[model samples]
Target: MWGTTFNRSRSEQTTVPCHECGAQLKIQRSCHEVFMRCESCDRIYDIADYVAEMDDAMERFMEGVYCDRV
Candidate 1:
């Protein structure tokens, strides 16, 4: 029952792989919003501009960053 709600079918989930290293992202919470980080390359990213959808489990959030180090 929990699986059906939290873990949707793999194909249906919107997973965002790391753009640089192709690593899975972990969710980190901020006072205003949430963000993603890649452990392998230490690349940080912002999945969405707003945090309104952060609580939804079914929606897979992609990681993104605001500044580019270059």
Candidate 2:
């Protein structure tokens, strides 16, 4: 039988400061895809890319939404 496993890391718990609004960005959920929510900007970020740069940028940009507060 084939099975799927789910794992989480410390970064998943990382509430980074929003680059726009300065609010904390939190990890909402992770599965086949990862979802992050910015409370300050009220934006939902979905990270489906496996590439390193794109993934990092998406996370950073989403976090920035909170930082910029827009």
Candidate 3:
């Protein structure tokens, strides 16, 4: 059930630089959200990329921790 409306009342938010406009964009945090739009340039960005990046970082951190414990 995909919808076009987004609730702006959520307090969970983060600021990230827009890829297209280079302006600070407010991103709402949600597990179901797959995409976000920049308010400045109206450019859309895939949220999966950010998630993948965080996953990769966590993997590396865990690997480092395991290596240190060995």
lDDT of 2 by residue, 1-70 (tens): 2222323232343345544576765554432435556677986654332223244434544442322222
Between candidates 2 and 3, the one scoring higher on TM-score is 3
Off by over 4 Å in 3: 1-13, 28-32, 51-70
What TM-score number comes out for model 2? 0.37
Error of 2 at 7 (Å): 6.4
Cα lDDT tens digits, model 3, 1-70, are: 3223433332223445667787754444343443445678977666544443333323332232322221
CA RMSD of all predictions: 10.5, 10.3, 13.1
| Candidate 3 backbone overlaps, count | 0
Residue 30, model 3, lDDT: 42
In terms of TM-score, the best-performing candidate is 1
- How should the candidates be ordered by lDDT, best one leading? 1, 2, 3
Q: How many pairs of residues collide in each model?
A: 4, 10, 0
Off by over 4 Å in 2: 1-13, 46-70
TM-scores for all predictions: 0.44, 0.37, 0.41
Clashing pairs in 2: 18-67, 19-67, 19-68, 20-67, 20-68, 20-69, 21-66, 21-67, 21-68, 21-69
C-alpha positional error of residue 47 in candidate 1 after TM-score superposition, expressed in Å: 1.8
Better of 1 and 2 by TM-score: 1
